[model samples]
Target chain A: MESLFTWNFASEIVLSTFRMATPLLLVALAELYSERAGLVNIGLDGIMSFGALAGFMISYLTGNPFLGILAGALGGVLVNMVYAFCTVTLCAEQTVYGMALNIFAPAISAFIYRVYFGVSSTLAQATLMKTIAIPVLKDIPFIGPLLFNQTPMVYFAYLMVPFTAVFFNRTKAGLSYKSVGEYPKAAETLGINVVRQKYVACIICGLLAGIGGAYLTTCYVNTYSDGIVAGRGFIALSAVIFGHWTGSGVLMACLLFGFCDALQLKLQIISKDTPYQLFQMIPYVCTLAALAIMGAKKAGPKAKGKPYLREER
Target chain B: MKLGGKSENIIIPLIAVILAFLIGGVIIAALGSNPVDAVGYLVQGAFGSKTNIGATLVKVTPLIFTGLCACFAYRCGVFNLGGEGQFIMGAVTAVWVTVSWGLEGPLACAAALLLGAVAGGIWGAIPGILKVFRGLNEMIVSIMLNYVATLFMGWVYTELLRDGSVPQTFPVPDASKLGRLMPGMRATWGLVIAVLIAAGIYYFLFNTSKGFQLRAVGLNATASRYQGFNVKRYMLFSFIVSGAIAGLGGAIELVGTQFRLMSGFALGFGFDGVAIALIAQLNPLATVLVAYFFAVLRTGATTMQVGSGVPTSVIDIIQALVIIFAVAGMAFVRLPGFKQRMLNRQRGKKEE
Candidate 1:
């Protein structure tokens, strides 16, 4: 028990927390945009799984992790195009399509992998993104090693944090995007193309989620496995809700969730007698608690989960 | 035109199914397997023998329960995604009783079944009450609860119930086992129970005044509230009933087939319930047929893999495609000229 409070353990927890939080950050950012644009894209888990598979497969074939990232986003676009077509264009039930895609995408990815690589084959080896430390920044105290010495995606994710803030708060396209979510009819009256805004938002959402998936495969795990995404996509969406759809708020939410995730993994190792299942449940329990506390007062998009039929108005 | 509307409802789903199979064929062909032979093997495997048919029926039994669960909540305007959790808790509680209490005979079976329903009902009611009181999104809450329930159940099995080599609980007492309808196959009295419950729910939903009020709440809560219906109460009731039905699915799968609680035994069945309900368009009776159809595809999946060397996940792709096309109102993909002509016809009718 005395050793449990050691600085060695504390630093490990802090470092792993950032690593665990990266995928959630990217995915939450994706869902943030889509939800802001009046679409409930809860199918991020499935989309992420597809992205992970495609990224891994491409990196395995080309030996280029950068190309893996690009292909991963493209994979996400292809899948979300179906979702955008159904929910945005055809005005299908958003929840139903999202749910179906959650099941469908992962199964298809797994099936393709199995067909190509056979069920008995070992995990494919691929080039993993190496840790890149920002030289001057790395010399600083506690925050330096924690934030500066990390993978390229980690730096990219942090940069996007501020980028998203500027994108949403100051940009014209972003303002129009928010308007489409708030009141599509009003936005239409104001000369904003509501459908077009939604389509772009949904596509961008997929692209970001794809990067999240690619990061999981090429940076963290370096091999594709079933369940690699493992509900991070869903957790990320919950973070979006917990943050009340703000960029900084989502960052805090993802950090909190990442802390819980990292704590669970650490506790399982340090405390052997405890039921590991209880430790495994921490992140999910946190999500439920956050939703319960924040849900009632949430100020989400007004036209969310509803189809926009221009002629009906 | 009225008759045409009803027929289109049937026609659209059929078209979606056919289109899914055709696309699936293309996928199979891309994988270098003969699509025709693969589908043939799938059909034959699902219905080749009495035993095969019985296995398919056994699969349908649980699906019916889960489908009805989704159907009930969907009709009341609730999306109860916690079928997986409710089902898991139901299986855990049912198995816990059988192992700890050591009940036997038909009376024991009744107790196990009743206890399973109650456990599931309580689990179901949690999210339902939360939605009404706390204004949380039931969909998100329910999905979270699924993980909690799954993890909790895993903890229970590891810490308490598991005393042997396997992670599952000890088998339920033979005396409490569901009676087999076929000696060699897995089909049991649960199938009859499923059918009767489906008919009962159909009667409750379409024929009874309370059911009408529930439907009214689903269709127009504001209007129902104006007419003095308790919208919140009905919504809660819908969720509880939906949970109970899904829980019963877990319980039936436990006593009727698996005879023990194992992690992931009921993994995708809950989502499969969503698919079934959607395909049936939330009709209770239609769920029976849809559940069976899904069951055939599921039960035949292994055979499809064996015969075609194509992964059985092809079924999942087909089901997803079916749901998308069936729900998406495939109206905008027509040729430009055709779409223009249709628009002109609509305008002409409006002018007339």
Candidate 2:
């Protein structure tokens, strides 16, 4: 326990904590956008599975991680297109459609994997994304080694933080997006295309979530498996709620969850007396606690999961 | 020439099923297999022989209970996604009782079942109480608790109740075992109990005053409260009942089919129940038929995989597509094209 107080151990834990939180950060932000636009993308789980499989398969076949990332984003766009058709166009219940997509995507990915690679070779490893350290940024003493020297996806995720915050708060398109979520009828009256805005927002949500899923496959585990997402996508959903559906809040929530998860791994190593499963359960338990405490107090988009039919009063 | 009526409820689902199957066939074709042959194998495998049919019935048994669980809560306007967790908790609780107490008879089995229900009910009630008092989203709460229940059950099994030399618990006693309905098939008397439970849920939801209150709350909570119903209490009551039903599903599966509790037992039956409930439109009576349909798909999925060399995950794809179409098609039929068709049909009828 005394050895754990060393700077090296602390840095490693902090580094891993941020690294682990990257996927959650991405997905939570994605969910935030959709939820803010009044569409509940409950199928983020499915999107992740689709993205992971597509991303991994592309990278494996072509040996290029960039292509994998693009494929992941495209896969997400395709899935969310179906979601948009159902929820936005058909005016179906958002949650139910999302749930269906969630169930469907995994099967689609799994079946494709089976057909292409055969059922027995599912565990075949793929080319992983390479980590690139920023040259000058890496020279800074304490902070440089901790934050600057990490994977490209990590930097991209952090860069997205302010960009999303600005887009949500500063831009005309952002206000229109919020208006559609809060009051679609009023937004339509104001000449904002409510359906179009929702479609766009949800598609973007899918893109970010898909990239997050690719992050899981390419950066973290580097191999696709059944249940590889391992409830991270769900955790990301919870992070959106826990963060109170803001970019900064989402960042904090992801960090908190990542810290819990990283700490669990550390504790399991340091202490053998405790059962490892208990440690493994920290993030989920923390989510429940957070939700229970915060509960439904924070009001999200007023028309969040409701389908907007233009003809309906 | 009616556009919207009671028949639309039935018709929409039928259309959804047809559309989903068409899409599923397309997927099969994409996989380089003959869609007709794949489907033929699926149907034949599901009900090819009496034994196969019996196995399908066995698959349908737990689904019936879980479907009722989802339908019951949904009717009262609550989403109980924790059915997976509650189901597992119930199974483990029953397994723990039978193993720890060394009980051997039908009476002991009855006790274990009751214990299972109680444990599952408690597991479910946590989220119910939270939703009522704290005003949390029950769906999210249920999702989180599922992980907790899964991990907790695994811990209990490995640490306390594990059978010697194996990952599973000790075998349940013969006296406690449910009697097989068919000589050569795995179908147990649990099927009858499942049917009875479905009937009971139907009666309770449609025939009783409380049922009416529950349904009223589901339709409009504010109106139900204005009409002197305790909406909060009913919400709580709805989840407890839902949990008990799901827990009973776990208990039944344990004694009747598995006879021992292992890790990963009763995989995703609760989630399937949600799908079943959606397909049935939250009608308890309809859940029986829907559960049977799903059971056929699931039971025959293995045969479809073996004979056609296609993965059984295709069944999941079909199930998901069915749900998507069921929700989407119901709304899509109200669009301009369908409305125009309805008008044309009405004009034709007038001419006739």
Candidate 3:
């Protein structure tokens, strides 16, 4: 146990935490945008599934990871439009539409994948994004190897943290966007296009979630499997709540979940006697604990799950 | 054209179903298969023979329970998304009772079922208690419990209850297995039990004053509270009852058909239940019919795959499309313009 807590093992765990947390961070940010705009989309998992397939297939066919990422974001936007139209235009229940998409998107994605690739014993592979080590940053002792030595997408996710914080706290457009969520009727009276703002939020949420899904196929793993996105999408949703809907808070929450995930994976490899299934349950259990501990007092946007209508007084 | 409130409810869902099938046909054609032939095969496969109908009914059994679970919860304005978890825990507990306890005969079966319902109720109460006492979001908590329950079940089968070389629980005693409806049929008494439960739920929701209070709380909690209703207790009750239903379904599946706990048991039935309940507009009796419809689609998909080379996943797409259309159509009918148009049409007909 003492040997296990060495500097090398610690560094490895830290690195894996960042690696595992990347997708969660991205998806949580995506959820943050949607929740802030007063639309709660619980269908992130389905969007990610679609994005993963689109990213993998595009990368496989074109031999370009960048193109795959682009395709993934586009695919996510396409699927989210269905959700946006149903919840935003039709004024339907947001959670119901979100849940419907969760079922719909994954089935359609799997269907499209089978049509393109057919069933085969061997899994198809895609080109993975290459990791780049920053020159001077890499030489900064402990922090350098832990953070600087990573794929481009990982850096992009970290960069989004500060950008999102500034966008939510500082920008004028951001204020208008948030107002729609808090008081859509008031926002409309003030000349803000509430429906347009919601549509835009859905698009951004879908794009980011898609990129997160793409990262799994094009950077983390070169192959796509059914249910590959797993429950990370839902975990990200919990992170948004755990973090209190703040960008930095979400980042910390995601990192904590990632750490748990990484530790479980490592433990499974090292210990044979212990049931690996118990280890696998750590992240989900942690998510529940985090949500319960957070105490849902001031959870999110006031109008968050309520359908907005322009015609209603 | 004359869209009264009652007629609109029935018409909208029917239109949604027709639209979903039309879109599904287009998808089949796109996949280079004859859509008409595929539909024909699908219908024939689901109801052509006694054996096929029995298989379809068998598939419908668990779905009816899960659908009723969602129906009950949603009627009380609670979203019990942990039906899958509750179902799993019930199956696990039933297996523990039957195999470990070495129980046999009808009494053993009854005990296993009872214990399974209790286990499921406890599993569901966690989310309810958290939501009521701690003010946690039940949706996320329930979803998290799903993962935990699945993992726990995995541990049970792989490590705790491993039978021989295979990663499954020991089979229940033959005497404890549920008797089939017919000697050679796959369908068991589970279907009758499910249908009877549906009727019980319908009666409860429609007739009882307690059920009225629950639905009243769902419709408007503030109003119900003002009228002297215990909103939180109703919410918790819905969760427990919903969980027990799902748990009972799991045990039934085990004794009635599966007879052993294995991987991939009762997969996707929970979400399918949610979809079915929503499509049925939260009516318990309607849920049974919708579950049967979904079962027909599911059971037929395999035969359709064999006959036309179109993948069974097309049915999933159709089911999802039905949900989207149904909700959207319901929302559309509620729009002011549509309502006005219907009113105007009715007035014109009256004058004429």
Tens digits of per-residue lDDT for model 1, B168-217:
77888888887898689889999999999999999999999999999999
**Tens-digit lDDT string for candidate 1 (A1-313):** 6877898889989999999899999999999889888999888988899999889999889998888988889998888888898787777778888887887888889888888889789878889988999999998998788888898889888789898989888999778888888899999999998889988988988898988998889898888887788778878988887888889999999999998999999999989999999999999888878777765664778888887888675
Ranking by TM-score: 3, 2, 1
Best by TM-score: 3
Candidate 3 residue B325 C-alpha distance from true site, Å: 0.8
Residue pairs in clash, model 2 = none
Which model is ahead, 2 or 3, in terms of DockQ?
A: 3
Model 3, B97-201: lDDT tens per residue?
888887798888888889888888988899999988888877778878888988898898887988989999888899888789998789999899999999999
If scored against the real structure, what TM-score would every candidate get? 0.95, 0.96, 0.98
Superposed model 2: Cα runs more than 4 Å off: A2-4, B1-4, B334-352
Indicate which candidate wins on DockQ.
3
CAPRI docking class of candidate 1 = medium
Compute the lDDT of residue A282 as modeled in candidate 1. 95
Better of 1 and 2 by TM-score: 2
- List DockQ, one per candidate, in order: 0.59, 0.67, 0.79
Question: In model 1, what are the clashing residue pairs, if there are any?
Answer: none
Tens-digit lDDT string for candidate 2 (A54-135): 9999988988887898899899889888898988888877777777777788878988888788878647788889888899
